[model samples]
Target chain A: MSSLVESTVQETSHAPAASVQSASLPRLGMAAPAFEAVTTHGKIRLSDFHGTWLVLFSHPADFTPVCTTEFLAFAAIAPELRKRNVELLGLSIDSTSSHIAWVRNIKEKFGIDIPFPIIADSNKEVATLYGMLMPGESKTETSRCVFVIDPVGIVRAMIYYPLTTGRNTDEILRLLDALQTTDKHKVATPANWKPGDKVIVPPPATMEDVEARLNAGYECTDWYFCKKSV
Target chain B: MACISSQGELSESARKMLAAMDASATPEDVASRTELPLFRVRAGLREMAEAGLVELNEEAYSPTQLGRSLLTP
Candidate 1:
């Protein structure tokens, strides 16, 4: 038991993008913009992933060193991601043939098959739709951007990295674990939290709730910062 | 209409609308899930209901077997 305080939460909407039809960067907690594009697996619509979580990521271009390493890393974790019901969709301002050539090259050389489809965004339609392009980095290439969309098509999280650095697949999986855990348990995860770790109990909204929280059996650092296992 | 081509595949908009549906959902839920405008979802649901692909129960819509055939199993 410890000192208690109360807080307030403002109701926010994550579903309004009725006027979003341009290439602007999408904000967090907003509905993901839609698009249709050609892929290594043929044409696909953003709607095609309605019931599944999607990792819509972009790299600089095919055949680039950093991007190649990323494909290998993603390939290594594709099976693990599928076990979590998350689909991987890659994008770049490159042609389908180039994607094919690069993927085939990776398979022939690195002996790893890229199980996911790579979007051939030569026209930049889908790339621009999700604002994957960073003009400051390169005019024609999409930067290393990742957008994690949930089952209902909401953009739950995004990460932007420079073209020079490859991303960490473990961190992506950890983020997915955190999001799904939060959804199921209705609690927030602490910094660097992983599976089987203590989750932060949502803070009390009133003084009475705060008082109840102290005896509520949580490991209370304070009422506002309690931890519990789901 | 444009919702169904001669090949019998659903139009992109119809597919999007249908993909957003589960056992039962309101047009508003479908709209937000697909990120399509509400008006389009309303119209699409009406059209799907007329085509026997979905059914209306008061304000909610549910996909029929025919509609389920078009989506991932």
Candidate 2:
């Protein structure tokens, strides 16, 4: 995935424009904000993941039922994410003891060991900095948010949900596949894009390029909108 | 209406509210549907009413035409 991004057009400007949209949420093609936090593994900094893809996600708290279900889901998929060189980091406004206890509970009840470090954001400074605190939901807890950051510190994707729901880990993995595919091929993902689905060719930025793209044999609704069977 | 602005298109919250509307649910059931604070639920209900997505009668609530249209499973 990192290599794919490297081959794409050297678009540094796209990253900053994406940074604004992803200011409070995770935005793709933008740098992830740096942070240092205490985790189950020990103190770690966001910079530690300087050269690897990262999935930095948050949960409201430990021992809660919904969060328990979500962590289990993430745990189930951790190995698959690891195969893709994506490190997973979980966060919550809980103490270290609380996080450990929750991990123990998961192990005992679900018979699954959470393979990744769960950040114990006791003070929630990390949560606040990441805009995880949704006052409309609960001031004391964080919402379910996922940030995908590449090796170069650019945020590649973000997903957010209201506190009522758990995230779709399937969707996250699908998105990763899609983003990687697009970066490698200079294409895009269509609606409900899955791993093997046809890829979209990014619309050209100029009239001549648009005609050239049309002549390139991509499926186009109009000259301005073109998709490829990649 | 813009798809993004439509309440029906907001699958995240719409799913939660629909799950809460079950007759078997109690106040605790409602709370479990979404992790929202009590005030947020009240606010959402008010907003839904204004959007013609829900109606309140006899201290109970039910989806209106617009809401039902959005909840088509």
Candidate 1 lDDT, tens digit per residue, A52-125?
78899999999989999999999998888877878899998888889999999999999999988788888777
Residues A1-230, model 2: lDDT tens digits: 00112211232333445335333444455556556566775555665565457899999989999999999899888878877767789999888779899899899999999978777887777787678889999999999998888766687787889888989999988888887787789888889988777777776788889778878877788976776665
Q: List each candidate's DockQ score.
A: 0.07, 0.01
Error of 2 at A80 (Å): 1.6
Best by DockQ: 1
Cα lDDT tens digits, model 2, B10-50, are: 44554576556754333234545675323234434545666
Top-scoring candidate (lDDT)? 1
- Which candidate number maximizes TM-score? 1
* Model 1 per-residue lDDT tens digits across residues B1-73: 3255558778887898888888899977997899764434665677678788899999899999999897654
